[model samples]
Target: MDLETLLSFEWGIMMPEFIILGVATVMTLLDLFMPKGLKRKILGWIGFAGILAAIVSLIGLLDYPVTTILFDTFRLDSFAKAFKLILLVGAALVMLLAISYEPKEGLTEYRSEFFYLFLTALLGAMIVTSSGDLITLYVGLELLSLSSYILAGLRKENRRSNEAAMKYVVNGSISTAITLFGVSYVYGLTGTTNIAAMREILLALNDSQSVYLLVISFLMIFVGLSFKIAAAPFHMWAPDVYEGAPTPVTAFLSVVSKIAGFVLLVRVMLSIFANAVTDGPNSTSILLTMEDTIAFIAGVTMVVGNVVALQQKNMKRLFAYSSIAHAGYILVAIASLSLFMFDSLWFYLIAYLFMNLGAFAIIQTLTEKSDSEDSSHFSGLYTRAPILAVAMAVMILSLAGIPGTAGFIGKLNIITGALVREQANYVLVSVMIATTVISYVFYFGIMVQMFFRKAKVKDPIKIPVGTGIVIGVCAVATVLLGIFPNIAFDFLQAQFYEFGDFLR
Candidate 1:
């Protein structure tokens, strides 16, 4: 393969990154120089508008037959387009929530910067979905990770904010370093960094020792990637970071960051495992070994995340654990890769985004009213803010995988896909069912506090229009998807499975 040929584009791939970065840079400039008043609001609008424009561009242009860009370092297809749309839409909603929550969090001074970082992080995640080479994937992941570290500490004066930032930076650096070392291992084993070329080399190997090189290198890379998604054992940093981060930042971390990490994992595993699996008895492929590893990881992460969450009293920390548990559900989808690689994961993520972020938006708004993050403040919330209580109830129901909500659809798809892979694997099936039951205890625990408990104080909580709009949209999306999941599911299936046909 000629290096020059590998460096290739159509207009479709460049526009998304270009428009997002332009808006982010302009917002950064405005944040640096604009006076502390109404002018800053304009910057926020501009950044939001820019993301809106990019979303339009993506929806308009993302369906043009799969194409390769920058010499195949990036690829454009329905799969990439679908994830980009989800990230952009989520970014837009988070921006509005940030506008409403920033003042309450004492982050009003840096509103423009906040939006700017959000856009940049969105751009990075979009890049992660599009990336087709190791180098491109690394660049996108780091861009997303660095922006998030600062966003985690957006409240500079808060000690927890600084501590979270410090921990994030320290651990992030170590993870990235470990990931780079694994990348080096893959490069050494394959003698190339291009995924397709490396897969070809691994497939050509004829002995177990040679193929073990393939499995070990991939596992090493998965370590760093898994940490980004907050899968258990590597998830120590997430609870404190989510609790300390500004609420919108926490929402972004939980949603956008997880999406990017999953995209990378799906791409890598599919490319490598699919090739090895198809090569037959002559090849020393480790696809089954890899799947077993992923399955075990998925089960443990689901059980541990939910069990730990059951003991948390703080809203953010509770949801932080919930996010980890959700990652396990996502892993179930990924583990079903042998049956269908992308459809179930994409469907689950779209729903997960609305359900999880909607929950966070309500938590942020409630914090504003009570001026607290403790879960106790939610006691008798139905009397104080019935609308929010109802919205939170819907989100919590969805998260708990209750029927008639988006979370239910997401969980249904995952388990159904898992069954497709191994209907008789009672262990995998039983664990998924049991862990989900464990999750509901905590999810409903919050709702019970809101609806069933009597108010300890007489004051009513006021919900801001901006915050309400954010949570309302998410609640509507959750309910809409539940009643008619085909809305997002059709698009996701078409983009991944139907579009996957184009690749073959």
Candidate 2:
């Protein structure tokens, strides 16, 4: 802890995190001093610029050697670099959405706080990606969770918003407790909190008792963290939260928050359990031993998500279920434990970002138009706003996994990865295909409302500059990535190869 020793450690690898922290702090101070009458939307613009800077900083660190600092609690590796890029880009888009949002009740009073809270949440996600120790990961998770809880309830006068916040806090606290209890078991068994050191210890242990302890701990951790990703049995809070939160916050949670959860899940499961062996006569890695269990959950998640979505009249609630189903799809890739697991997961996440956010942008516009989020809001959308209507169609098609869209390509990659495994996950893959078909019924229901129904009002929807930018970027990315998927795949493969033995 001496100054000289601390100074000797390489800190340059932390530039992105430092930039996010600086931005959040500066925005908080600005919010405190700014005149009450001044437009708070400018803070969102500044936050967006800060995210751009952080993205640039991250790009610069890609060439640096993988390094851990602060007594091995933080590490910069390929996984962290790649995932952090997603977090930054995703946050920037959400910031734009925040800037454009103009609710009927007017969120002007709390706009500045919303902007900075997003930065804090982004910082938390970045921290989770780079963390190399269990304690650091837990801190990052709570930081993100706490900020999100407040964000969900930002509409001060809305009873639904307040209720959403309450549910989130209660569920989040329980999940945190469960995760910590699991971590305690791990620390007790391995006598270390560092992921790498624990891996070595778990690999060396061969006793049946140790194996049983590891299994119990893994179950505890997985169940708790599943709440973060909105995986089934733990997904009850998502629809209500999504419907109640501000549109921008909903988009942020669906994309950035979900990505962070997956990053943490992949990090913990692969780092701690990848080398731990089972207790049977024909011993296997803990991940492989638990594959069936994970697959079962994945199957149920997809079925419940899609089937329940069929009954939803509210747009936000429908998308909430859709998000849950997508999580299940990605989990199949994780369960397969394929060599290209990260590749499949990353590509799908990127696709999800563009398609889902684009859909939300349109949803926000439509819902605000009529002050209702019902399916009727989309009726005769094509006649009222043809261009925006087309954009909505593209996003909906992509979500339904139609060919010539990013979601389709992403699903193809995931299915291919699963089938290529030595022991193919036929059951999980079959379930995914069936559920996807079921999903189309609800997805197309919106389409039918858009194209065939009559509008309650004849006025065209006006798209703001910020909102237009998001929709344009997302639509373009979706089509381009679909047509030439190899662009992203090539980059992912190169990075994976460069990283050399992930989670070792």
Candidate 3:
């Protein structure tokens, strides 16, 4: 801990996180001293600027060699860089939505706090991406979870918000406890919390009892982490939370929060279980043994999420289920365990950040206008605002995986990834296609309401400047990526190729 030793640590690897922390601190202080009557929306702009700065800083470090700080607890590698870019960009978009957010109720009083909470959550997600140890990963997860819990209940007077926060706390606590118990078992077996060191120990294991313990631990960890991604059976809390939380918070959960969850899952499963060999007559890696189990979970998640969404009349609730179904699609890539896994997952996530957030921006605008969350609120949207109606159609079509949309290309990559495997995962692939078709029923339903139904009120919906920016950017990105996916795919392949060994 001497100054010279501390100086030897490559602190430059942590520039992105440092920037976020600094920004959060400054925003908190600024909020504290600002005039009582001053508009809080300015704080959102400040937060957005900070995230832009952080994104710039991160881009500068793209060529940084694998560097671990604090005794390997935090590592800056290609994996971290790629995912952090998504986190920063997604947070930036959510910040825009926050800036323009105007609920039916007067919840603007806490708008400044909303911006800062998002920064903290982004920090946590960034940390999780780079963390090289279980303890640090868990710490980051909890940081994100706690901030999200508070954000969910920010509409303090709304009973649904209160209930959402309560459910989040209860569900999040149980998941954390289960995850910790699993980590404890892992530490007991390997005698180390360091992921790299534990990988070596687990791979060399020869005892059957130890293998059994490892399997149990794997299941516990998988089940617990499922809660974060809103994977089914564990996804019961999502619809309520999405419906209750502020619209920007809902966008954060769907895009940034879900991305972090998958990052953590990929980090842990690939690093630890990819090489952990089970001792028996037929020896194999732990991940291979559990591939079918993981596929089953993926299948169920897609089915449950899409089927349930069909029944949802609330726009937020419907998108909540949509989020769950998308998680299932990403899990398909994970279950494939192909070399192209990262490429497909990252591409899908980037596309998701654009299309999903754009859709939510429209939902927020309409819901606020009608002062209702009903599907009927969107009736005759084309008659009132044809431009926005067209934009919403693009987003909804993307989500439905139609041709010439980013979501379609993302799914194509995933399916191709699965099919190219030595032993193709036909079952999971089939389930994915079926559920995606099922999802179209709900996705197109939104379009049907917008284009076909008569408006209860004939006035045009006014879009705020911030909302317009978000919708414009997201819509452009969605179509661009769909047509020219190579822009992102090429970059991902190049970057991931260099860090490919880290997963091994």
Candidate 4:
């Protein structure tokens, strides 16, 4: 903690965080002091550039050895660096969507706030990925959560937006308190806030009471953090929030925010809980004992998400349910505890990011044009805008896990992960397969609206420049990743090498 020691720590590895912080700060000042009549659309472009810059800086750190600073509160490692790239890329696309977004009410006031708020949120997500201590992770989580709550309600004139904000904050506060309570228990038992130290200390613990406390702490933290990923039991907030929030923000929550939650879960469970040995003749990790709990939650989430989605006529609500189901799929990978856990997660997230965001872009375009959220609004899209319809179809195909798409490949990896596990897990795999089939009912309904139904209007849908770029990039990436997944796997393996540095 001494000034000399602090100054001696190599700081170059943190360039990405520093860049994001600096950009958000400067943008905040610009938003306040600028002329009232000056258009703020340029601020979105500025934020996009800043994200790209941060990505470049993050890539620079890939070759560097794992480094810890601020008393091991911040870490620069392969895991952090790899996931940070996804965050930066995903956030950058979101900024583009915001720039292209045209609200029905003509969003004029607080235009600049929208851009910078997302930047700050992106900053928080980056911090969460790199955090090495419990306190640091929670701070990062709160920063992201608070920003999102405001972003959800940014449409001050819309009553739905306001309501969404209220519900989000209330739910978020409860979850935060629960997660912190669990963290307190861990710190009380291990007498350290650092995750590395907690792991080492927990490994030495074999008493029944201590092991029981570890189980309680894991469950408390698991339930608390499940809110972040929109998993079942904590997922009631997602449909309403997604329905009311801006389209770009909805996509960000479903992808970027959800991924960050998983990172937090992995950081905690795989660290301390993986080491706690239960008392008695046969030693078992605490995490293994909780596998059924995780699997059960995952199964319920998939069924609830897919089954409810069938009844939703609103596009956003359907996607919200879709988001919930996807979270369940990821959790199945985690509970399996297979050797491919990290690979499955990374590939699946990448696949979801492209397909989900692209789908949202099309949904926003179609809904804004029709001024309706009903799935019927997409009727006969192909007749009016052939290219846009095809793009949307690609996204949907990937989302439904159709063959020869990225989603299918991702799901294959996940199912394979379950099958290859050391112990029994056939029941969870069966649940996943059944839920995926049920999801097709709604997923293909959109396709029906797009390709088979008659047009509600004859006019061609106009695609914005920014939105066009996002759709094209996401669609192409989705198809390419599906066809040649090894390209992505090579990068992950080359950079991370099984995430070994995570514990060391």
Candidate 5:
């Protein structure tokens, strides 16, 4: 912690995190001093620019050597660079949507607060992405979780919003406790908070009882982090939270927040648990022994999310369940541990970013127009706003994993990776396929409401320029990535190159 030690470490590699922290601080000051009469949406523009700068800064650091700072509390490597890129890009888009968002009440008075809160949350996610120490990881996790609790209840005037906020905070607190309990066990076992060091110590241990303790810690951590990802048995909070939160915040949760959970998963599971010696017959590592358990969780999550979604009439709840199912698909990649695991996980998250955000933007536009969250609002949308309806169809189809879309390509890679593995996960793969088909019933139901149902209102819904831009960009990207997935895969391989230094 000495100045000499700090000065010796290259600070240039941390520019991305520094930029985000600085932006959040600066915007908080602006929100305080700026005149009440002036437009505050300018904060959104600043946030967007700041996030783009972070992206550029991160790209510059991809060539920098992987290094840890401040007693290994912070680290820079290919894993951080690649995932931080997604976080920044996704935040930038969500910022635009936030600028365009027009909530019914209360939020207008606190418009500027919204922008800085989001940046702070993004900062937390970035911290988790780079953290090498368990304490640093927990701090970042709470930063994101606590900020999300506030964002979920931004509408002071709405009853449902308040209820959603209460539920979110309670569930979040429980999850945090569970995660810390696991971390404490890890510290007791290895006498260190640094994960890389723990890995070295864990590999040397041959005690079966100690390995069982590690497995218990793994389950505790998995159950806790599952709430972050909206995975099943812990996903009940999502439907209510997503239903009540503002549209832009919902998009942030579905894409950016969800991706950050997976980041933590890879960090904790792979770094500390994946390589831990099981010292059992034919089992080289704890992760190998736990694959079947992971697959079971994945299967149940996919089933619960897709099956429950079939009955949801509210748009946000439906998408919440959809997000859960998507998480299950990515978990399949994690469980199978195929050579293509990184490719499948990273690419699916990218595709999910575009596909989910685009759909939410459109949903926001429509629901705000009709003052409803019911599926019926989409009825006769094609006749009222043909272009908007068509774009929505594309997003929904992508979510359903239909061919000729990014979702399809993302799903294909996961299945291919699963089947091509040393021991194919045919059972989990079957679950993925079956649940995806079940999802189609509701996905196409929305399409039917758009194209086949009669219009409830006669006036054509006008789209704002900001929302229009989001829809257009996401739609085109979804299609292009589907046909030319190599564009993403190539950039991914260039930046991460198989995530070798990731677990280190």
Candidate 6:
């Protein structure tokens, strides 16, 4: 196949990315020479507007749907579009929070650069959702990871921020290296970098060693994604990084980065494992073996993430671990990859973005007026800023999977997906139920601090309009998606079927 043909786009399929790139460039130029006062806020608005344009473009392009794009290097199914919408909305909210945060974080000089990096990172995530070739997926991941490293280091003067950046880069680089090694192995085995082509090659192998090949490749790729989602054993960098990096960046990492990794995982597995049907003597079945491996990872990831999070006292670190537990829940969908799994994953991500971002944005707003990062900072939050406190409460309750909130509905779908496949996934369903209960304790623990405790120290909190508005919007979304999950799930269900057909 010609390279030009592979890279060629339908233009309509490429509009969101074009908007992201164009706005990112304009923001970069504005940062270089613009006068120093309130003008910088324009860049934040521009970034927000850019993300809105991308979201609009994504909605508009759904009318011209195709299951795959760029000669199958990309796919434009419901799964990809659903994820694109989540990422765009989450990134836009983060941009709004950052508008009020840059001055306080002492990042005033480089605030415009934040918009530039944020847009690029958003672009990378959008690319990951759409990428169909393994090579394209890898490139998109690297672009997103590199931008995140820089974002973590943006608060350069703080020792913790610098340390977090170093740890992130080192840890992230090692994971990337492992992922590439696995990709190389897959290439050598199949003589192709195309995921669809590789699945055909893998399914043809029938010996015991084929099982070993599958295990090794999945493990290597898992290393990279584990880091992205902050899963255990690979989660060492997250607590320190979350405690140190700017709060909006933490929110971005928790929501956007995790969603991107999961999107790629679903795409790759749906193509390679879900559809691998072969009849041969001594063949180790592709779909069953992959399901078992992912199920094991899902089990271990939940236990480790929640157990470790219980020990953290820092609010950011607590949420960092909370984010990991959420990652484990997302992985359960991967463990049960099927037609319904795609819908479950997208709905869950939409719910997670609201809960995670709304929670962290509140922390960012409150932290400005406090000296400590502990949960104590939230003491008497109900008494101080009742509206914001209510927003934070809604977010935390949703995250805990309490009824009448977005997180509950997301979890409900995942549990239903697991139970529907329970005959083949009994162990996974049991583990998932156990982990969900374990997670509720940690999530509600924060809510207890926010609502039940009285203030030991009295300091009035100041919240920017942008921050307040973003939190209010996320709070409303959390409630909306929770009460009416069918609306989002139905919207996503229409596009998710394309993957089922493509895989078959």
Per-model TM-score versus the true fold:
0.93, 0.98, 0.98, 0.98, 0.98, 0.93
Off by over 4 Å in 3: 369-371
Best by lDDT: 3
Q: How far off is model 4, as Cα RMSD?
A: 1.0
- How far is 133's C-alpha from truth in model 2 (Å)? 0.2
Residue range 312-345, candidate 2, lDDT tens digits: 9999999999999999998988888887788888
Candidate 5 lDDT over residue span 1-504, tens digit each: 687887997788789888989998999899889998889988888988998898888888887778888877898988888888889888988998898888666466888888988998998999999999998998999899889999988888888889889999999999889988888878899999998889899988758888889888888998899988988989989999999888899999999999999999988898998778777566578888888988988999999999999999999999999999999999999998888888888899999999999999999988864345999989999999988998999899899999999999999999999999888989999999999999999999999999999998887677877788899999999999988999998888776764868676
Q: What is the C-alpha lDDT of each candidate?
A: 0.79, 0.90, 0.91, 0.90, 0.89, 0.79
Please report the TM-score between candidate 1 and the true structure: 0.93
User: For residues 134-180, what per-residue lDDT tens digits would candidate 6 score against the true structure?
Assistant: 88888888889999999998887778889989999999999889878
Candidate 6: where are CA atoms >4 Å away?
1-9, 36-38, 67-70, 102-105, 207-211, 275-284, 369-371, 422-424, 494-497, 501-504
lDDT of 5 at 226: 91
Our tally of clashes for model 3 stands at 0
Candidate 4 lDDT, tens digit per residue, 143-221?
9999999999998998888888898999999998998888888899999999998889988888989888888899999
Predicted candidate 3 versus true structure: per-residue lDDT over 89-175, tens digit per residue = 999999999999988886668888999999999999999999999889988999999999999999998898899999999999998
Q: Count steric clashes of candidate 4.
A: 0
Superposed by TM-score, candidate 1 places the C-alpha of residue 36 at a distance from the truth, in angstroms, of 3.9
TM-score, model 6 to reference: 0.93
User: How far out, in Å, is residue 299 in model 2?
Assistant: 0.3
- How far off is residue 207 in model 3, in Å? 1.3
Residue 138 of model 5 has an lDDT of: 88
